[model samples]
Target: MTTWWLMRGDVRVGELRQYGVDQPTFLCHFVSGPGWEAVRELFEAWAAVQGPDPDGSRNAEAIRPLMDLGLTLHPSDGGSPLTCFKGCILRIYGDRARLRY
Candidate 1:
């Protein structure tokens, strides 16, 4: 299991926790912080996609938090990628952090 720091500058808001060969889980569990709202939005949007109709069917895309603002899809061992918003400042961690472009 690998846990990467989802950081915005020096402040750590959330985490992308990978558990074995399966898909990693987005741990957006935050209390109070500067970027806490963004993490909360992500957590809410992602939480809605949980569970399934036996075959794993879900509703609309969980990209609502990244609506008007920009988006970055970082790389991980998880099959379904995780979303982390670092405000307007865009910083790429090589191939690990990409703009989905």
Candidate 2:
């Protein structure tokens, strides 16, 4: 599975799977940092549900935990047959971090 490096500028907060739930080897560091805690919770929720955006289907519940954390998907994904599956939220949060830090 593809992995996305969740970074805060030069620093890597963690890596998340590109699709499906992360494996046992998933890594989450800097728990107290910007994206770490939220990302951890998102991953746990995804793992418990098997995966997010399953079979290219929009998994609303999979991302519910991140709603308050500022996760947003492209509106195209809101309709039947998503534009792309497992769309990353890192960009949104990363930008937020950039502004704050």
Worst 10 residues of 2 by lDDT: 92-101
- Give the per-residue lDDT digits (tens) of candidate 2, residues 19-81: 333343322221233556546656455445544454744446665655445432222223332
**Model 1 regions lying over 4 Å from their true place:** 23-34, 49-61, 67-101
User: Each model's TM-score?
Assistant: 0.35, 0.31
TM-score, prediction 2: 0.31
lDDT of each: 0.39, 0.38
Compared with the true structure, model 1 gives a TM-score of 0.35
Summarize candidate 1's per-residue lDDT along 47-96 as a digit string, tens digits. Answer: 55656645433433554444334333334454443344433222222122
Q: How close to the true structure is residue 65 of candidate 1, measured as C-alpha lDDT?
A: 41
Candidate 1, residue 82: lDDT: 38
